[model samples]
Target: MQRYFVAPEQFRGVIITITGEDAHHAARVMRMKPDDQIIVCDGVSRSVRAVVLEASPQEIRAEAEEELLQDSEPAWSITIAQGLPKADKMELVIQKGTEIGASSFVPFESERVIVQYDGKKEAKRIERWSKIAKEAAEQAHRHRIPSIQPVQSWRQMLTLIGEFDLALFCYEREGAAAHGKGIANAVRQWKLEREKSSDEVVQNPRIVLLVGPEGGFSEREAVEAEAAGAILVGLGKRILRTETAGLVGLTCLLYESGAMEGA
Candidate 1:
């Protein structure tokens, strides 16, 4: 079934309204018509099965038939804090990362970063990324769309380290014995802790995995990140590009959390 995302307010009781580009796609691109079945989500978990009542380029209205309880989102809230890569590589990361179950993305500036965000077009860039995430989420049958955070400076990103329950940093020079625990061990430990915790756990534990730019993080930067509560993890013997490292780290977290398993 086709899926669409709308604001929370767009849903009024049994009536659901889809506007803007989504409407255009459904009405024109897909040639959907009345009585067609589709799914609509609030982009924050809530979703419903609906039968089209009206379809047009301006707007598409549907009546909710049943509420869907989809368990498509990952158990862990994984955020990829990536260093700005060159060209459109960031877009590729966001698109594929969402399909792979990343909950969010944050672009940060690092010493080895080759590309920097332009202030003038920052809003446009963010919009593009958010759209990519939304489309990816829909295509992947995800219950919620991944969020895209604005580009953060080295200092700013470091200050936000305490925000997540855990932060994993992928360092090219990182080692298991020297850097505390390897990623697999660290994630398993964290999962065990979560399972032992009481029901008072209000939300999925948030994890921010940081990956450096093309050349990776400098020794000083890695040291400072470790000091700021970020667990440094090595991605193995071979080197990966800035765009691939975060995705690999996210995959590790997802697999460790049993997110790759069937529900």
Candidate 2:
């Protein structure tokens, strides 16, 4: 079934009015007719199994048949605090990160970052990244769309680390432990600890994963991240590009957290 996101205000009683670009796509591009079954998710995460009742040039109306659970979301919220990379790599990060169930993205300016977003350019960049996130969410059938927050400095990123239960800093040169211990091991450990104490599941655990820029973080920056309570971990022996590292880490994290597994 085809799926699209709608605003909460568009939902009145059992009827949902899909407007804007999506309406155009349905009415013109897809050429959807009346009685066609489709899925409509509110940007906030609520979804409904709907069937088209009316289709017009500017709008498409559907009747809600059943409320759908957002099972694709991970049990824990994972936020990627990535150091801004060069060129259009941010766009790729936003798209793939959303598909892997990242709750949010924070683009940080690190000491080693070569490209910087300043003044009006930052606003424009954020706007573009937000649109990419939305489109990616729709394409991935995600109930909730992940947000691309404004760029932050390395210091500011440190301040925001405390908001999460666990903060992991991916470093290629870290000597703390071998990268062989995959993300699954970390999640299993956390889960086991929680399960031993209580039968209740810890839903919505917050995890923040940090990835450095193209040149990677300086030694001082890595030290500062650790001081901010981030655990420095290696991805593997092979060095990954700034664009590939964060998404790869996030995918493993989500899989370990049970967000990517079939229910």
Candidate 3:
């Protein structure tokens, strides 16, 4: 069945009103008709199994048959604190990250990062990235859309260290011990802790994964990140490009954390 995202206000009882671009897509692109079944996510908590009851040029109304579980979110929230990369790599990062269940992204300017973000350019870049995240969320059938935040400086990134339960910073220049205990080890530690907890309610773990720019992090920057409470970890033996490193790290994190399971 086809799925569409709507606002919570658009749903009143069992009836859901879809307007704007979604309405146009239903009426023109998809050529949907009354009695056709579809899934409608309210972009909040509610997702319903709905069937079209009315279809017009300007709007499409569907009646809710049953409320369904939201399938777009992952079990754990993963936030990527990526150092700004040059060129259009940020666009690909935001789009693919959303599809893979990243809850939020923060692009920071690191010592080794060459791409500088002035106020105006930062605003424009964020706006474009936000649109990409939204579209990717829709295509991925996510219950909630991830946000692409404005670029932050190194100092700003430091202040956010305590916000997450698990924080890992990928450092290519780190010593051999860092390379030995990869992302898999960190994930295993978190899982073991969770299993050992005596509390009945499972605590939702928030992880902050940091990735550096094209030239990677400076030694001073890596030291500062470590001091700020981010555990410097390694990906593998080979060096990965700035664009490729973050995604690979995230993929491993998600799979290991079990966030990529059913959802």
Candidate 4:
């Protein structure tokens, strides 16, 4: 079935009003008409099955047929704190990362980062990335759209580290032995701790995984990150590009948390 994202205000009682570009797509692109069954979500956590009651050039109104309980969201919330890569690599990262179930993305300026985010162009860049994430989420059947945060400076990035339950820096220099626990083991340990502290109920534990740009992080930056409660861990012996590293770290995290299963 086709799916559309509706704002919270658009949903009134049992009716869902889809306007703007989504309405245009439904009326023209999808060729949807009255009585067509579709799914509408609030773009956060709520979604429902609906049938179009009316379709016009200006809007499309649908009546809720039934509420849907979507369990596609991951058990843990994973945020990718990526160092700004050159050109369009950041777009590719956000697109694929959303499909892999990352909760949000934060691109930051690192010592080795080459791309510069000018004040005038920053909003447009963020808008473009947000669109990519939304489309990717819809295609992947995700209940919630992953957020695309504004680009941050090195110090700003450090300040945000305290928000997450765990912060990991994916450094190519340090091998898995840096923490005495590999990525897999570290995730398992976190999960075990979560289970033991049921009373505390760390539902949706937030994690921030940081990846550096092509040149990678400088020695000084790495030390500073480690000091700020970010664990330094290695992906593998083989080095990955800036875009590839974030996705790899997220895959390991989701798989370890039993959110993404392998055959």
Q: Tens digits of per-residue lDDT for model 4 on 1-263?
A: 88888789999989999998889988999999999999889986689999999997689999999999888888889999999999999999999999999999999998888876687998999999988998888888888888988889999998899889998888887654544446776677767877787478677789999999999999898889888988887888777988999999999998887886753
Q: What is the TM-score of each candidate against the true structure?
A: 0.93, 0.90, 0.88, 0.93
The lowest-lDDT stretch of 10 consecutive residues in candidate 2 is 175-184
List model 3 lDDT by residue over 16-112, tens digit each: 9999878888889889999999888877799889999999769999999999977557767898888988888988888888888889999998888
Q: Please provide, for model 1 over 53-153, each residue's C-alpha lDDT reduced to its tens digit, 9 standing for 90 to 100.
A: 99999999999999999788887899999899999999999999999999999998989888756889999999999999999999999989999999999
Q: In candidate 4, which residue pairs get closer than 3 Å at backbone N, Cα or C atoms, i.e. clash?
A: none
- Using lDDT as the measure, name the better of candidate 1 and candidate 4: 1
Positional deviation of 243 in candidate 1, in angstroms?
Answer: 1.2
Candidate 1: 10-residue stretch with minimal lDDT: 173-182
Candidate 1: regions farther than 4 A off: 175-181, 191-203
Which 10-residue window in model 4 sums to the lowest lDDT? 174-183
What is the C-alpha local distance difference test score of each model? 0.89, 0.84, 0.83, 0.88
Better of 2 and 3 by lDDT: 2
Cα error of candidate 4 at position 87, Å: 1.1
